[model samples]
Target: MEFQLDKINPTKAIDLYRGMLKPRVIENKMLTLLRQGKISKWFSGIGQEAIAAGVMQNLNNDEYVLPMHRNLGVFTSREIPLYRLFEQWQGKANGFTKGRDRSFHFGTQEYHVVGMISHLGPQLGVADGIALAHKLRNEKKLTAVFTGEGGTSEGDFHEALNVASVWQLPVLFCVENNGYGLSTPTNEQYNCENIADRGVGYGMESHIIDGNNVVEVFTKMKEITESVRENPRPILIEFKTFRRRGHEEASGTKYVPEDLMAYWEKRDPIENYEKALMDADLLTKDDQKKFTDEFNEEIKTHLKKANNAPPIESSIEKELADVYQNFEPKNLPASTETNHIRFVDAISEALKMAMQKNHNLVIMGQDVADYGGVFKITEGFVDEFGKERVRNTPICESAIVSAAMGLSINKMKAVVEMQFGDFVSSGFNPIVNYLAKIHYRWNQNADVVVRMPCGAGVGAGPFHSQTNEAWFTKTPGLKVVYPAFADDAKGLLISAIEDPNPVMFFEHKALYRSQRSDVPTNYYTTELGKANLLKEGSQISLITFGAGVHWALDVLENNPDLSVDLIDLRSLSPLDTEAILSSVRKTGKALILQEDTSFGGVASDISALISKHCFESLDGPVETVTSLPTPVPFAGQLEDQFLAKSRLEKALIDLANY
Candidate 1:
């Protein structure tokens, strides 16, 4: 695409300068605070300020921005309160997240800022989703997602880019090529000479620009933004720049050679941009000084306001905020409404019920419709529901999630299945980004259910036998359900489909054919934030969910002398704390067991919650029994060692000893 300089308004140059200056001030102050120990952590946008300013400058206030950690410049240009930004860094209740999210993770829904600082690559899919929403609504708004060149290596990047290209979404992907990613140089990180070239493979327009040059960055962004607005095609922007500082407060800059640092120092975006303005007769020394003074004063005022603002009285208020909206609670099926059913059959039934009730419901993914899914969970769905609702999609996990987000924003319920959960890494972007944040940001609900078959024991190798449930528990605004029995499989699936939010419905392949329970044939709904207490006792509270719930139940039954209250955590996100506390109160001892690795899993959250709320009531220290931090072995014997049954039994014996 050729640039059209005559069409660009010269007045925007001044607006762009003002926009760029604000972010610079914010970044400097954040660094100052971090150094002084007033803030525990920070991410700098020091050298790459122009790229952030340029992309956001071209976007309207109503447009969306889903940025990575170094997007302070973008938010600053959008006029997010600097003091609130600082407060977020300080971990104060008055911060943007009210201490819920880390400093770099702060974002505002009111400003159309969708995803915040999460792991790289996810926001690209979110930007595509926001753009998809705008396209569906016939709204004229573009979405720009910013990331570093290093993020290109993540599966999410390729997945999101491919979807946006295929969909012709009004999304502009801005990649800040800051020479290096932390300590790793981009040359070693990626094979591509320029990140923009990757877009060519996706058949999208791509642009490469001098990221330090404000004029070049803004002009290039404006051209692409206009093109996207006109035809609703996705664009890739590779902003070539440098990072002046380390990745975070604790990171040392000694990794970079002095020559490389000095060479990039000459290309300082702020200094170069100031010189450009001066040389163009647009801004003089006095004008720059005055702008700086006014900006500093504004920062002081914002800091005061943010500092004095009241603390978030309740951290758990927005805890279940995006779970569902504008949906009335439906009564559960009567206890008599029970019939013996298999897990897979129950899942299919749940989908049928959900589809029949909501016209917005849809089913898609590899072999999901005509092929009836790999495990036949969606068998005969296409014939029954027709093509529009039971769509047979391409074999692309990323595109599936991205398109689901589009359907979700249009108020359609999307049931996307990955032949197996192990393949979900291919589409992790949209799941974490758009699907999770659609409702949280625009207050526009995303009723998308991602049916993933997770866990091992089916002999599916490393590629097919992985459990990534723990990877998503740390993410907010996402509901992850792992059903233990056919009843929960049906009930939770039904509830997940009906709920106006995105849910990761992980059905263990091991249980799909092995387990059977009497599930309700009649329509029923399950609570999104409640735990099920299957058995009650006083010796210890056996806290577990999903396939692990069976092991806990088996332990309780097999060891009659070991009285244990079994709590099944149906929803992992909101995590029915009230029920957990109640169980802990009754049992006076608790043991958290899970099939996922012990490190960074649900067990950690359960232990933390118990310690905070029900500490004094404990009969013994809370116990956790989980798989060791390692990949699931392919061998049956080795797999058995990683299962929760053995671990739960050991934990029970230990709790009884305590």
Candidate 2:
């Protein structure tokens, strides 16, 4: 794209001037409010407004923009009302987040803006997902994601760029090189001459433009966005700008060199753009004054209305009510005729059936397409659904997980497989912070299901074998489903796919082929938040889930005289309190067994719940059997000691005799 200022349209030039000026005016007012204790915080985008203003003006309403905190121009250019933005800044009930989040920390589907979290890198991967969705649907839309120059140092930044380039997704990586990240300068950030150069490593188009020149930013982005929409590939644009203000109003710019600050002040984006517009005879001094006055008056009117609006206290109930979707467990009739299958096959069948039912469902993971996944759970999936649905992603956990959230933003469902359970730690930030909290923060549903092939017994060691369900069970807004039987696995997986919220589906690696049951070949759904009672007895209640169910069942089979009530908790987050309490109340004694370690495990939480709710009904103290708190070893003998089998048998006998 050639940079020809004379060729720029007068109307577009004026629109770009208004775009940059609106944010300059808004931020100045916000800074005043912050000083007066009217608003809590302010991340000033004063000197660097040209990048957002220019780029956002060229985008359509359908194209999504993931903006950082400093990109106020993005909201203004999208024509978001001043009053609503004021409400959001004021933490009023009528704000975009309904007071759940502050500042530009919320996404709004109405304006096609995906908000950024404090962790700046994760959204890059999310942009990949949104772009992936557009590519899959053959939509001529692209996603533009912004980050500071310092954000390029993040692992997610590299991973997102590589994945976007490899997949040839329609994404625009907009890097605003403001010289510093918080207090650290560019010299300490990266040794590269330009952030755009990093794009070359990813095999993508790259460009460097004057961030202070609104016309140049807009011109370059116009060409780049058009090319990406038509061709569908990633491109990186480095906007060389400076941050005149500190990271936030509270973080004073004592570290910024005085000479450098003075240089940026002279090359101010708004001042330079206003001059260029006037030079081109598109805007006059009087015209600028009128626009400034109108914007000021608009700000004043909106601020007054926002100040008068009720605080979060008024809508606290509604805010809490919107946290999770109210999905009642369906009581579908069980299948009478069935075919016996392994647990892994049941999940494959469920996914195949779900994809057949919902054309928008996508399954993504490493080697999931032709390789049939590391466990062969998705064998023959690519043959049925094609490569578009059965996506094979790079070794980027954080990117793929965050991408799943992106898919959900476009009303699409994504199933992400974490080759093994422990790998979830790599994707934890997006799962717990973004996917699990997006709904409560911005009323956006994260329709993502993460499949974790968890648990030990295959001698895969700590990295590959881990029953880490407890980590997500404690996180709110996430459904944790762990099935013990093939039938239950098929039903629960289908239900999780149909769910409008994020779900953590844990598939025990040991039970992939070991567990077999008569599962229905036809489509069916198993209710979440409901526990299944596999056995009924009066002596004691054995509460467990996943592989623990097999351990308990084996003990029951060996000791025929032992009267035990066995409960398999399919869902952990929406804990089946009634089922757990009822069995404990009937037996008057309870044992909580789990494959995860004892400390901070699901077993501990269940024990506390039993002790709190069924204290009077208990004959003695509630007992628990769990694996030792140690990293799983590869050696068979050491792994056995790390498991709960031997200790579970002893705990059952002790609790039974008591």
lDDT of each candidate versus the true structure: 0.77, 0.90
**Candidate of highest TM-score:** 2
lDDT (Cα, tens digit) per residue for candidate 2, span 420-517: 88999999999999999998998899999999999998899988888999899888889899999999999999999988889999999899999999
Off by over 4 Å in 1: 1-7, 28-42, 135-140, 248-281, 284-286, 308-329, 332-343, 356-364, 379-414, 422-448, 454-488, 500-522, 527-658
Candidate number with greatest lDDT:
2
Model 2, runs deviating above 4 Å: 1-4, 314-320, 328-332
Model 2: lDDT equals 0.90
Q: Against the true structure, what is each candidate's TM-score? A: 0.72, 0.98
Summed backbone clashes in each candidate are 0, 0
Backbone clash pairs for candidate 1 read none
Instruction: At residue 489, give the lDDT of candidate 2.
Output: 98
Residue 573 of candidate 2: its Cα lDDT? 74
Lowest lDDT sum, 10 consecutive residues, model 2, at: 1-10
